[model samples]
Target: MARYIFVTGGVVSSLGKGLSSASLGYLLKSRGYKVKIRKLDPYLNIDPGTMNPFEHGEVFVTDDGAETDLDLGHYERFIDINLTSLDNVTTGKIYSQILEKERSGKYLGNTVQVIPHVTNQIKDFIKAKTSGYDFIICEIGGTVGDIESLPFLEAIRQFSNDIGKDKSLFVHLTLVPYLKSSEEIKTKPTQHSVKELRSLGIQPDIIVCRSEITLPKGQRKKISLFCNVNIENVIQTVDVKTIYEAPISFYKEKFDYQVLKHFNIKNKKQPNLKPWYRTKNIILNSKKEVNIFVVGKYVDLKDAYKSIDEALIHGGLANSIKVNLNKIDSEKLKKNQIKNKLKNADGILIPGGFGKRGTEGKIQCIKFARENKIPFFGICFGMQLSLIEFARNVLKLRNANSTELNKNCIPVIGLIEEWYKDGMLKKGDLKKLGGTMRLGSYECNLNEKSMVKKIYKSKKIYERHRHRYEVNIAYKNKFESKGLIFSGLSNNNKLTEIIELNSHPWFVGVQFHPEFKSRPLSPHPLFASFIKAAKNKK
Candidate 1:
């Protein structure tokens, strides 16, 4: 049986519960214990699939095509695990399933309530497909006192009793605000937060306190006394130079030791955190740096491209260089302002996004990057825009654009009307917008002589995608004749997966999102190559 560690937060939001959980999971995994991390969001959006990036941040897609919360990105990066849709559970997903069961008469005319029915659904989702794992760290989203999260909290409380306390552990993360003027840290908020959690019938076995500075011995004792936790189990987490240092920091504090002790499990081996230490050292001590401009619509919100941001850092780590990301909002970018905006750019990257809000500005940026011979990388929507830019400038196609932006213009890119997957036909609907894209991992065959093939050193590669539009293959011959390279193809040469410019110093675009798979230990080949190209340009 897998011991469950339920991570909950209080006092405020954005307390780094996800990171804390992932770091602990990494610590245990390094000590030869099988570990898995999951997220239980209290939101009612089914998933983050249809939610706006500005409101909910990036929607992380798993290999099985589930659009999940951005925290899953942190989990995957830290634990180095490939999670599936089953790892993420939300109130929206739980309620949707319950309603479907009710409509299908699965309840046999019984009145449904939140207690037995809804809570049962949440518990079931928690324990699904979790066999053979020594530990499962489940982070509950939202703060402790939020009304929407009450059901989830109650569900976990019930789960603890049902599974026996020995098989369950609750780790509560709370903030300890430090007043500069008073020069003292406050533990009152943590006390009240733990009190609130206790009111929900859940007592935390460990208290992870988030603070700007180290907690004094007095403050730690006070928190332990008020929160009803052991003094040794009260862990203090301060801001680190980089997030990758979190696991090492927590390991030094013996956070994993307390977790193992709680279950009365003995592990003789120590955690091997050499990879994290090396990654952190490289991140902080790297001398060379490259500036890259990431032009996108959601640039204002840093979390909007969380995975992309991390992936770039991973790429830089692989090259022993520091990546300076200048996030440029495409919607506000003017044609004349391109030079000033990207003046120091060693590389130009256009990340994935939806909508036509900043289409023209993105195309303008692509044109500047291409004409100036700056190393450029485009992904998903950015790739389509690159094709449009190429068609308008090189192919001399008048007013070239994607059908997503303008239906009347020349269809340099158009909606994927039909596609084949595993010998079965699939189609997307223009009316419905949720969970309908060509998502998850797909295989792409690389041209033997292509630049990507040289970078990846493989003829076939699999990448994850989350888009509805594809470049028209009929223009491939025209594009290839004009020095454009359609270097990768999927679905038996019908879909374009990668594109490059033959004449430029380094310009590439990929139809799939490679950022999802990039890791610090082993960065994705494309991002690593992109960083190397940027460094070479510098």
Candidate 2:
């Protein structure tokens, strides 16, 4: 039987529950156990595909096209595993399944209630994803006392009994707020939070206290006594300069060892955290720094582009340079101030987003980069707009625009209503916004003597994508004749995957999201090249 560890948060949200679960999985996996992490979101959205990035960070795309919570990104980065759609479940998805079953009379006219019906479905959803893994760490979204999370909370409570105590564990993460005036880390909030969780008929096996200062010995013992957990299981995760230090910090506190002891699993091998040591050293001691300006629509919320921001940092680590990202609001940027905001910047990057909210400013910046030979990297929507800019300015298309933005104009970038998928051309219908896009990983073949081929140093690559429209392959020949090189194409050569300017310094745009695959120890090649170009420009 597969062991389960359900992680829940209390007192507040954004307490790094995802990171805690991922770190636990990392530790267990390093000790020679096959592990996978799942996210149980209580939100009503079937998936985060259509959600605003400003509200919910980046929608992490699994290899199987599941638009999961951004926490799944943390899980993938820490565990080094490519998760699938089965790993992410939401209230909307669960209710949709239940309602579908009821409508189909699969329930046999039974009144669908939250007790056995909903909870059983939740249990099955959790169990269905746990086959072939020794450990399954499930992170519950939102806080413990929220009403929306009641169903999931109840399900996990009953799930522990169904699976037996020895095969299950509940890890609770809560805040231990410091009273600055009194200069003490009060444990009352954590106590009450655990009390609330217990009221729901679930007791936490471990309490991870998130605070600014490390917990004192007396406070740990006090928390253990109050929460009815072993003192050693009360792990301290104070604020750190880098999140890569989290596992090492918890290892020093023997957090994973306590988890092993609770599950009665004797580790056959010790953990190998040497890679993290290198990450820490490079992140802290990189003497040379490069400035990269990120012009995007959602500048107010940094989480809106969390993965992109982290990828740049990873790229910096790969090149032994510290990357300083200056986030500029594209919608608010004036044409005259483009140089002012981007002056002395080594490179400029435009990340992906939906709608036509800030296309004009993006085009202006792209024009600046192309005309002045500044290093530029454009992502999904970024890639689309780059083509539009080239068509209007260089190719003289005059009224160039995407069908997604203007359907009646020159459509250099058009919707992918009918495209090849798995080597077959299929008619597409994406009237709804949710899970209808061409998502997940796809194969791309690089052209010989192309910039991307030189960077990747390979003839073919597989990258993850999450876009509804694609560049018009019909104009591939004409565009290439005009010096706008189609550097990368799909496996079937039906879609353009990458574009580059032969005459510019380092101008490239990609249809896939390479940020999802970037790592701290080994950044994505495109990002490393982009940063290298930016550093050289400096």
In lDDT terms, which candidate is top?
Answer: 1
Residues 230-331 of candidate 2: C-alpha lDDT, one tens digit per residue: 898899899889889877887887888988899897876878899888888778887899999999999899688888998998888888888988998999
- What residue runs in model 1 are displaced by over 4 Å at the alpha carbon? 418-435
TM-score, predicted candidate 1 vs. hidden true structure: 0.96
* Candidate 2 RMSD to the real structure: 3.1
Model 2 pairs in collision: none
Q: Give me the overall lDDT of model 1.
A: 0.91
- The superposed Cα distance between candidate 2 and the true structure at residue 231, in angstroms, equals 0.8
Give the clashing residue pairs of candidate 1, or none. Answer: none
Error of 2 at 223 (Å): 0.7
* Alpha-carbon deviation at 329 in model 2, angstroms: 0.7
Tell me each candidate's TM-score. Answer: 0.96, 0.95
In order, the Cα lDDT scores of the candidates are 0.91, 0.88
